[model samples]
Target chain A: MEHAATAPEPGPARVAELRRSRPRSPLLRFSALAGVALLVWAWAAGDIYESHLTAEQKGANLDRFLAKLTPAPVRESGDWSDFAPWAVRLLGEGRGAEAVLLTFALATAAAALSGVFALIFLPGAARNLANPDPLGIRGGRGGLAAAGWHAVSRCTRAFFVFTRSLPEYVLGFLLISVLGPDPWALVLALAVHNFGILGRLGAGVGENTPPGPARPVVAHGGGRLGAYLSALLPASFNRMVVYFFYRWETCVREATVLGMLGVVSLGYLITDAKSGRAFDQMVFFVLLGALIVLAGDLLSALVRRWLRYERT
Target chain B: MNGALQRCAGSRRATLLGIALAALLCGWLLGLDPRRLFADGTLGLAGEFFSAAFRPALSYEDPVPGAQPFLLAALRSLLDTLRFAVLAMAVAVPCGALLSFFASSAWWPDLRRHRALGLALRALHSTSRAAMAFARSIHELLWGLLFITAIGLSSEAAVIAVAIPYSGILAKIYSEMLEEHARDAQEALRSIGAGGLAAFAFGLLPRALPDIVSYTFYRLECALRTAAVFGFIGIETIGYRIRLASDEFHYREIWTYLYLLFALVALIEWWGAAIRRRLKT
Candidate 1:
């Protein structure tokens, strides 16, 4: 009887059986309605009909534009010699190597500063760690202290929201006006954004921490701060490191974007190449940026591996 | 045990030293100078910029002739940004889904049993993966600039620029989601003689659909941000106006544009959280 039940049914019966077993999903219907609404919105917004040029004309134009972007043969033989000089020029006069180094420096500085800021604000922001009365005190003194801590927690949370909401690009723009187009502007912008992200993540890790280790600290007459410092932070350290590395990856990417704002990074080279109509050079710079980002990703992966190995 | 502890301590020191050396080299190579940080008038300028936030221009006056009023213009720009983002996602999400179907290893369950066919499928999967990586490696800002150069300042350029990299990202993520969830279901279906596509549709897709939807909503929020950034490259979105105001020292106007952007992002964040919550339940 078990063997018979396990066997596949015939086609018609199998289809019916499959249909009967399928779970009802309202999400599908909701998504379809949302998609249709999006389409109607797009239509009304005139994005669908915004372009005046016909499709064929646009295609021809795009083809021509791409044709213009293609680099001309540098030598009669069409060999590597044609590209060697450009590469050399990019490294020497264009300061491609310097740009890469600067990008790395900016990212590292930002990550370091953000890590510090995140640590400073993390206890206050974390819902669990910031609890007003972890000791279950019922007196007037405990109530007042609890109220004060709650206010601090609320303020820190609001700070995180405000900082993270502003994009690094906007921050870079604002910083440039004040800092006079120096590298510090980009560094601070990246730091501010990542600080918020890391702090929020740290707070989340704090909230979800298992009570097994921290409870003892509190039960032993340790203050809330003592419990957090001795137990909660130690427990969440690894997760905080993970978040920091993740943010570091993004910081490298943002550093490149910040270059477009006149900070002498790889982006600046790309911008210059574009203005000069040197499409080949622009492509080269973009490839270089990609390499730097890939290297940063590789480094992060290695660090994560090392951390895991150490843990084990 | 003592020796082992000493060796572990030595290794930890070595790792720390290595990291410190790398940091030092990077800093030195970049000529990291902090003396210029406190340039003349820096504090005053920053103060002014911050103060403007509290007094954002809320007037109905049009900055450009024949344009809408201040609030109306902001709303219009927000709509445009949304429209571009949605259209880009519409293009990206389907293309990404199709690509992921080809890219995911779980979709090709017969690969191990059939050597030649497996080789072909594996090659296709690797190629698709590489293509997606290359597509997303270049940031959207670069893509926007490239499209602007390729086709001039047009909405199509903005939409296409946003679409390409986002499609790559979606494809990479979607493939991972499918692969992670499809294993058990795929085996069950294959045991019953269902074909790859059938197994995927009936088995893998349902389980992965929730995660994919949630991620897509998160990507939508990202796309909105990207669209605003694209405006800085001269697409006439909110960022473009903000840039204009900033360039002309109209800090209040910049704040106004920024507030609109913040409201939009906040709304999307709320919606995304709601959808994710629903998915969880």
Candidate 2:
């Protein structure tokens, strides 16, 4: 304890010293790329809606997509069309609790895998985000106020760069192209995307560790990576749990949408039902997906409370 | 003490790199290779096809019946794409937000709420997320295809395909946002005996409202893109038009529509960003 009293005060000199050196810039490149991608996505969506479907076609599509699968078959209705009703009917099959359970089970597994990856990525991110600047000093001159504001602005940029950089669909699109239509393809796609997401959160939580621990370790000849793991990761442990539960829930939604690659989750079921004109079954799958999202929310909430209880 | 290059030789990085390589391998198996066009002479054929996409000359003759209604048809396809995306966002946001509360930590304080309540809520939350995730995993084209087969080729089919997944996405994202801000304000509001609904309204809503709107716009943009892609299957959406024009050797129409789609996305981003800035202030 007495060893701490001899520690030198880190002031503007130290601030200037740290600021002179470069900060890693990979994060910046990723942010810019993400911004560009988002713009492109927006342009594509805006230019392509109205002319996609004709009035008559739109009516028939909606009806068929919503139809329910029955034991009985139906004759084709219009003179201009030769569309079959099997896809929607198969999707809109009977409302079995078992089907809902099966769907949820698959989605949960996917989410859990992403959560595990998030856990793996957290330690690395936390270390990289450790601020070298000392506490109680200004961010600009030598005061606390400047430091606080700088931190906020930098963090905000990072946050935006993180969340908006990649959409799940884009990831799914890329992965589906690469990994085929398997269920694991969707899972892997969601996982990589989630990795980027949770990594940013982990970095934010670890941003407050004082430089003392990291500086001392580095000065004593320890590697930068060592200082990061020891000082940064440990400091942010408390916040990791909260983000974990939250991300897991998100994975569930991603799993559903990404599963549109013919990987049978409830979404696949919905599409099939819609194709078969199985209205009731389509509704069932939609409702079922909604319900599963709700359950993930609750589970995460429970996990959060448990973490808080542990902390207390 | 160690060199940066030396540090890079760790087992973890190698493992990560290996895993990525495997994923790449799997991706290869999926047949998503854009290079396939060249190998099959498909690229040269595509060039010829897309050349016509530009043919219907951007003359004053367009929108007049004689030469080609190129400009008008392009504009019309663009509108349809925008409409599909907007409508999908409309359906997705509210439902996602409303359900987000249930998914958020704001609802469950402890794992043991009550004997039956805990079990029931647990089931409900899990099911909701699972359902959303699974639903969203499907592609819009497939969704369109599914709907097309069931309901026949129509805009409604496109809308359903887009909405189902976007809803899952919005709900998941919104819930995560809520949980990240679950402390303090929420706790204080709860301490005041605010009901769940009241606490959400008084404490959380204000902070999240702007972000929610921004993301909704973002999702709208995404849905539009997905809807366009779906247009390739059967729908006459912008994507479908581009594909059709290209297929029919109408390069001018294809270029016109594709550019229109790109422009619309930029405009939405600009407007959305402006609104976000205003809100921030």
Among the numbered candidates, top DockQ falls to 1
**Cα lDDT tens digits for candidate 2, A1-312:** 677998657999877877877454543455458555645564455433335456687676555444433323333343323223433444344433444554454444444455556555444344333233323222233457545545654654443334333345444543344344645556555666566566666666755555666666665656545666666555454466577667776666555555454664565666666566556556556555666666766777886787567542
TM-score of each: 0.84, 0.50
What value does the lDDT take at residue B173 in candidate 1? 83
User: Which stretches of candidate 2 lie above 4 Å from their native place?
Assistant: A1-312, B1-12, B27-43, B46-68, B105-124
> Can you tell me which runs of candidate 1 are displaced by over 4 Å?
A1-32, A48-77, A133-158, A309-312, B1-35, B38-40, B60-67, B179-195, B198-204
lDDT values, one for every candidate? 0.76, 0.57
Model 1 quality (TM-score)? 0.84
Per-residue lDDT for A182-292 in model 1, tens only?
Answer: 777888888997897789889888888886787777777776678788788766666666777878887887787689989867788888888887777787888888788
* Cα lDDT of model 2 by residue, B1-281, tens digit: 37743443343355345435644454344333445434444445445544644554463322445644667766776777666666666667767776676666565644554678778877888888776666655544445555655656545556777777677778877887776664678668889787666777778877776687678767776776676666656556677665555445455554556556656775666666766665555
